[model samples]
Target: MASTTVADGIVDRLIDWDVARVFGYAGDGVDPILAALRRKEDRIELVTARHEEMAAFMATGNAKYGGGPGVCLATQGPGAIHLLQGLYDAKLDRRPVVALVGQVVSTALGSGYQQEVDLHTLFKDVCAQYLQVAASPQQLPHVLDNAFRTALATSSPVCVIVPHDVQQAQAPEPGQQEHGIVVSSTAYARPRTIPDVDDLESAADLLCAGRRVAILVGQGAAGAEGPLREIAERLGAGITTSLLGKPLLDESLPYHCGVMGHLGTTASADLMAGCDTLLIVGSNDPWTEYYPAPGQAKAVQVDVAARNIGTKFPVDVALVGDAVSTLNALVPLLPAQAGWRPEVERSVTAWREVAGQRVAQRPSRLNPQLVVHELSEHLPADAQVAVDVGSVTYWYARFLRLPPGVPAHLSSTLASMGSAMPYGIAAKLLHPDRPVVALAGDGAMQMNGLSELITVADRWRGWADPRFVVLVLNNGDLAEVSWEQREMEGDPRFPTSQAVPSFPYAAYADLLGLRGLRVEDPARVGPVWAEALAADRPVVVEAVVDPDVPLLPPRQPEQKVRQTLRALEREAEGGQAHELLRAQRAHEEAR
Candidate 1:
């Protein structure tokens, strides 16, 4: 009999790849793999969640921060089923994540055992690639090899279904495929082409002639911060970011204007509208709603994805190149002139003061606006912040400027709840040298996965440093959605019994051997948040926000959402016009 088992081979491949931890929960379907993973715990740590769903989220968070594929394992049926939501987040966000689901014995797979579903069918569409590993001796490394390759190459989710019988079976003879990983990083499928210097100079000349110029940063400017700031400084242009580009420039920076899009600030939009030229850096937004209003400014768009060029508005210039490369190429062509940047900055300052004055006038108790303002001032520059989906998502998405490249892991599109705790665990694994904190909601935290605190404890050795602190905006109900629903259709009596429900958020913290604090007074929040950040272990703060306070807006959602729906509906009701609605086209909203 061969000394090595099939389980041994599977784990060895993972261990060789420098995967520091694996996130999952134990069930009968994946028991053998769990046992095998444990044997290599010194090299590959095994992290278990209360639910397999959390495992997937944590794994993607790890991949997002670590810049590689993350591994998640789950059992049959509901275990595999629950993992889909987080997996879809990874797929959409373009993070590489792999899910290993354990099926029943190969013979029992289609026979419908207790927790059996055709996982291949259930997961195929959601994943970039799905593979069903065979239960024979010769099918060794080929299965494992394909899983790793597909994940990295596409930067999308992949699946490898391991049957229970196959996992526990004896190992096969040594083969070439077993040690056959190329161990290479995948290149971007679409690299930004270098633009012509003459074209860049022509665009630069147009921008220089304009009296007011503003630069718009989008997610496409992932690594172009330095060049962007340089361009802004050289041209005396105002700088603002898209929702995804919030951290590219610090909010406290003098040149920082407000954000762009439907959630954009009035002041930011107004300032940009006054500009004679708007230089879009690495954005592909087709809708004018995301940019300035129609005829607000003449536009020039740059992108690495060539297809996105001039797809939105009538682009006066389309610079087909990487954002950083283009900016470096364009900087020398411009003549130095102290132009409208100072005026733009002054306007932004005036607007902030006006908004602050308005906020200062409203002395509402349990004001979340107060909490956000104070917290933004206090958080350390390097501390990582993660948020949950709900009221805080709107607040932080609109306001919190932690700095670009910090990985503020949160869900978009799906906007599922309870990703905070799980993503915190993954961030800790990825960023062991830094602290990671989660800002979540009370009602949103009800979806389970509290046990992941223990995983942080395991990594931090139960010390009380602010490695992971979860701040709960506990307003007593699912008030964020409730308020949005009420404002949308007058559905006043939806459900409120569980709205103010209290679970011992602190009690669970103690159970997990982590420190917990509850902030009842708004005055105590500034100090409480500070104390939480200073701790060495995981911490939880259950903050009581006023349920009556505007989560979205008391009466503003209908007009805003209706406008969005109508714009989207119009695009959907037509064809190439659909691109504007599709977010794939550039100019429907502009037109």
Candidate 2:
């Protein structure tokens, strides 16, 4: 009988789960596991990332794009610690991920040995389930199985920590099985949570009673677009989406009012304010101030998690179920009403006119809005977009129109920077037939780590019909932070917000052997994007945009206006005085 090592057992279990890939860095603490991974290279491929954080981001992206539990591995201490940011991104986004951490030898633990730390306590908050110091070889299979199972079942991250010595121990012979040891045989599946008939009837009654109804959606309503559309058409409702739910429906639909919140559209904000009844589906949007005021409207909420049903606002009827099932059951109970459709259509038309003018406005440098809008026009109908957080997010949220069936991923909940590139790579890896683009800002690209672009370049040769593209809005500063400081604190631009050096990102892409294009003229933005999209390999397009363009909110708060006025007065004697005065005038005139 052949005896296998605990590390081998763990790898075998991963194979059983059909997880053929892992992203991580190899280090001394994880040598045994690395060796096992090498032996199984034909069956499972290891993607070595430039940083552990990038590995975690890649894993999270994999889970999101592929619809399975993403796997990442890292060594003890610093390596494990580096995975937190990406792990938190996965946790907050509610994606399934499994992180395998290597620990110090069992004997060396608590003896101040090198690379030893209490990983369980470190990961307690981020992980839905955590396991540390697997005592014996027999426990390896169970630990691996449980990690994958918990991650998939809860749609959250799970961590399994293995000691170096424990992983090297020999497993029991094939016939000598331990009693009471049961390895999980559960497959990765998410059963729909349907609401009870009473709950559905109650929600339908509340919705039917209102004169004007509006539907608000989030990422959890991903596959229920048809049902949602049917219900909205029946009730003559306007549809507004949270930032994460922007791609859930066709943006070109007449009743679609676009995103709602700070980065939302004027039409969406207006529709939500005027509605008599609001039906929220699968969104826990935290911006309470943007929602309809309490007692102003009757609210109905549908969510898989019972705790989230009424947490965002007071609900008249709470239907606790999956978005598709609940929407399907409630559509028949409502009567057809044509009262609200015309009002919503008019608002949407007016908002689109204003947006069209903004997109056509020519600045001294390229307009970020035009770049995103033009990209949207040229994008394939089924393209997938991953947007990084920053001013770039404003352009994407406001201008990029995704048709139904086109998926989009963003770091909305955690609102992290530098996630676009990793997400693009993962999306491309999983769906090689579709076009994937990462929209990022210059500062965010540098902060989150752009070296991962090389990972995409390295793997591009193996991909079928690879169409990965990275579009960078290189404005040479942290534009979003600068605008926030001026709007919130009445402060003039400082060194920290205005001192990012412009790097040759397109040239860097060329050095990595990926197709690269740089556009400084506004006229060239569309042409360059077209060329990048047509490239056979991974490509990057860097467009120089104006840093002076302010990202104004949909509706500027009074306090924000006052702060801007104070900031303009303070900068009266500075070099930007004339520019600031012009912006202030334009802002006032727009309102």
Candidate 3:
């Protein structure tokens, strides 16, 4: 029998923790660990990504969608450096991810060896929860155990840097519990948490006192849907979700005001503005201006993390506990009523009409809104969505109506581009039987998504379900930033900065041995989506959408509108875009 090495020990700990896969790109620095993984291939799979950054993203996505601490590995120096973007994504989004990075040999600690880096210092900020360097073979088990535990307990990224020499060293024997040895077991269980009874009562009292209440939820309120609905029904409250929270509740509910923020709907704006009392459930959405003006609404916040309470909005009562536990306890205290329901329903109804009008616009080119809106009709009940950050995010936020329980995730707080491809891949890997749709803008596709497409092609044949669809909004402009410049700075769309070089995304997909469908005409939008969703293999539907379709924020004030119009007037195609903006704003005002 082969004696267990420290690398083998690391893999053993991963198996003990039930980590099914580890995503990474190989390098000489991690050769020992890679060999160990290859030997244990039957127990735990290694997912090779095109880039280390993408691997980290896959890990982060796994954590977000799979509810486990995602594990990623990388070699020393550049490979470790490449993992930062995805690590930061995990950090900002507060997802549990354990990153195993290789370091230089233990003896070369001070010597500037080839591919050597100060891995601890580099990972310190992103993995602030825990960072450990294993110099001795005896320390491997404890360090790996602590990395997993800290990641799971804190719901944030952690790092374990193993020197090359340490990985090749002999592992501690089963009975080796000597004086200098620290043996640690691999196990962690989430504690059932609840706020104090008095705090729950205080929150209940605040909700009861309000005539019109609005419940704003974020990702933290994920499992509390049942109790959340019950409390909303009792308080006669309207429900609105932050972009991250959009998938937590059923949008089909009459009083559900889609999403709240710049990318949100008019009904959500009204829900935030009209409410006298607010119940913020596990939401730390940063759009403070969109929230009810500081003193307008009395608020109660429930969050698992105490640090998040009163950080975004002023709170009358803070219930630091699991959302489900807190909301369940507060439900009985709320008075049953239906007075605020009708008004909320009316707002939802009006917003639907506005959304319909916006998507129905028959522009000369394909309207981007129509590109995503058409998917709502054919979206599968079991599908998972991965959305990139850009104008595509706006369309997804406003138009796509996700079926109840269909999870859609994006780089929300970090607002990172090129996240959709890796995120979608991770989601699909977790549930091979379920289909996945990734939405991306031209700029985002070019950033890192195009390269990750090769990964999709490489793995699709192995998946139980082959219906992985990538929707690329192929407008030759960085539309989101262009609009932001006009809206925020009153600057005209700068062609040099905004223009994205044209690329035939559909053609590239076809070359990669996947089904490719191109849609430039407004007429083919629905049919193409239908074809892609039903394809036998992975498909890329490249929609040549109009770049000028304004990313107009909900309830835009007169001054901002004027600024946007002034910026538009200086552009070549301003007339058409100006008309589209006017029409969209008219829909909101008329609502």
Candidate 4:
């Protein structure tokens, strides 16, 4: 039998940490590690992606859905550079990810050899929490243990660079103690934190004093849904979530206002504007303009990280603790404000009416909103959802009503495009028994989604339940940026810049041996979704939607509306879009 090499020991340490998969691409720089992975294939699987960037994204997705430290591997230079985007995604979204990057031979250091870019400078920002270069064979478990530990403890990405020569070196014998040897174990447990009595009391007192209470939640508030609901009930408060927090809470709650931001519902805007007390839980949402005006509400912010508190909004009381414990501790001290419930309910009711109107509208082409709205009824309770960034994100935020306990994730902070396909693949691979739904726009589909589809086609055969459904909104335009130019800059749609190249996404799916369904008429939207969800194999549903339908922000100001109307008037075929914008703005005003 071959003696254990450092690369083999690295794989062993990963297995010790219960890592079932490591997403990556192969390169000669990491040949030794790839060999070890092949030898230990039974214990840990290597998931290869079309690009190193997608591999990193798969790892980030693994962390998001699996609730563990996700691991990814890559070769030197270009491979390391490609991992930055996904690592930044993990960092901004606060997910734990560990990147095992391969480096050039130790002898090649500072020789300016081919593919010898500085890996440290490239990863320093994305892996600010923990970054190290494994210099010797004996550092095997020590470097990996700290990488995993720091990633989990900080809920961020970490990096470990292993030189090619070091990976080929013989691993030190077990229990061998030497002056230079360092030993470490893969043992980590999340701390159960609760705020001190004084802080909890102060928070409770502030909450009790408000006649109109509003609560904002983010991803950090996950797993504390029960306590959150109970507290909302006790305080008669309205709850709104950041886009990241949408999956954690049930939208069916009478007092629940959907997401809060530019793409958020009118109910969330009303909730923020009308509240006297704001309770922010585990959310550092950057949409400060959508928040209640300064001095409009006395705020109490709760977060596990102290730095996050009061950073987004001014807080009178800061509760540094986990969401569940913090909310539970304040429950006993908060008194019921039954009078505020009616106002909160009114906002939710109006929002429902507006959303229904928008989805039911008959635009020149099929409405994108209608496509996502139809899924609410057919979506499986066990399905996982991955959404891409673009106008599709707006539709998803407003229209899709995810079943309670069904997990959905998106690149919220980084807002990266071409993320849905990779994320859906990761989620499906992790829980092959559950179905996955990915929503993307035409622009995102062309960016990288098209290439990742081949990865999906290759892997679906192994899935226990091969119901991976991808919804591609084919509008032939970069609708989000088009609207932003009109609204933000008072500029007309720049066809040269915003128009997307037409592609037959559904036909391409059929070519790959996957079921493909296309719906151009509004009447076929629901049936297409039903067919896709029940298909024997993975399916791609292409909905040809109208780009003219407005992505108007909730409670859009008169000045911006005027600007958008002026810009629309200048477009060659903007009359329909202009009329739609006016109607949307009128509906919001009516509410």
Off by over 4 Å in 2: 1-3, 174-180, 572-591
Select the stronger candidate by TM-score from 2 and 4.
Answer: 4
TM-score of structure candidate 2: 0.95
What tens-digit string does per-residue lDDT give for candidate 3 at 109-218? Answer: 87998987888889999999999999888787888889999999998999999999999998777646789888788767888889999888888778888999999999
Each prediction's TM-score versus the true structure? 0.81, 0.95, 0.98, 0.99
| Model 3 misplaced stretches (Cα beyond 4 Å) | 1-3
Q: Which ten-residue region of model 2 has the weakest summed lDDT?
A: 572-581
lDDT of 3 at 524: 90
What is the number of residue pairs that collide in model 3? 0
Worst 10 residues of 3 by lDDT: 169-178
- As a whole number from 0 to 100, the lDDT of residue 346 in candidate 3 is 97
Q: How many residue pairs clash in each candidate?
A: 17, 0, 0, 0
Tens digits of per-residue lDDT for model 1, 528-547: 88888877667887776655
Q: In terms of lDDT, which candidate is stronger, 1 or 3?
A: 3
Candidate 4, superposed: residue stretches over 4 Å from native: 1-3
